[model samples]
Target: MRAVIQRTFETALFVDGEEISRIPSGLTVFLAVCRGDTEVQADYFARKVARLRVFRDENDKMNRSILDAGGEILLVSQFSLAGTLGKGSGNRPDFGHAELPERARELYERVRDKLREEGLTVKTGVFGAHMYIEQKQDGPLSFIFEC
Candidate 1:
């Protein structure tokens, strides 16, 4: 599993011109399940993302986790994150590095539920849907997790 996480003041997802998920203040995470990913990878990812200390602290250090800040999570499925294509990850057709749709969807749903179970208010984008993910924060810190 791989994820590109961005801290945002707000985020939302829309599919077929209808809003599907939203968060007031939290991280907007774009995740992809690689072809070899399994439940163990998903579990490790959830724990790492949950403990990330990107939020600032009283001492001006990166000392606050999302759980500590009481923030939510906007999880979006982006299988393209795994696809590399011929010209790298640029504009081109995906070369089949990503997991199959059915498997990816299952893993994505699992990650979302697992995160929510960890006590964060987790919202999710529709799996396998053409959706738009909007992050409403500029200059936010971003991180990518591989697990």
Candidate 2:
């Protein structure tokens, strides 16, 4: 499992030109499930993302986790995150490393539920839909984590 976390002043998800979910000030996470990934990895990434201290503290230092900063999370399923360029061939991307759609959706829900269980406000985009995401990034802070 992998997650691309971005600190955002605001983030929203839209599908078919209609807004679905949005967060005021928090993190927007693009989550991916790799082939052979399991629920254990899902849980681990959820906990890690929630506890990552990327927000600023009193002295303007990056010292607060999303939990500590009282922020929400907008989780979006992104299978393309697992895409890889050709190893020794033409410049073509391969998505062979991504988990199948059904299985990936299960893991994605696991991560979303885990974050909710941790008491963080969690919003999610449609699992397999064409989504349009809008975000006002905060400090352009971003991190990628794999488990």
Candidate lDDT (C-alpha), each: 0.85, 0.92
- What are the per-residue Cα lDDT tens digits for candidate 1 across 1-147? 878999999887899889998899888899999998899889888888899888888988889999898789999888778867566657876747788889988889888888988998898888888998677883568888877
TM value for model 1: 0.91
Worst 10 residues of 2 by lDDT: 84-93
TM-score of each: 0.91, 0.97
Regions of candidate 1 where Cα sits further than 4 Å from its true position: 85-93
- Which parts of model 2 are misplaced by more than 4 Å? none
Extract clashing residue pairs from model 2.
none
Per-prediction tally of clashes: 0, 0
lDDT of candidate 2 over 1-147, digit per residue (tens): 877999999998999999999999999999989999998888888888889989999999999999999989999999889988867636878888999999999999999999999999999999989999989999898888888
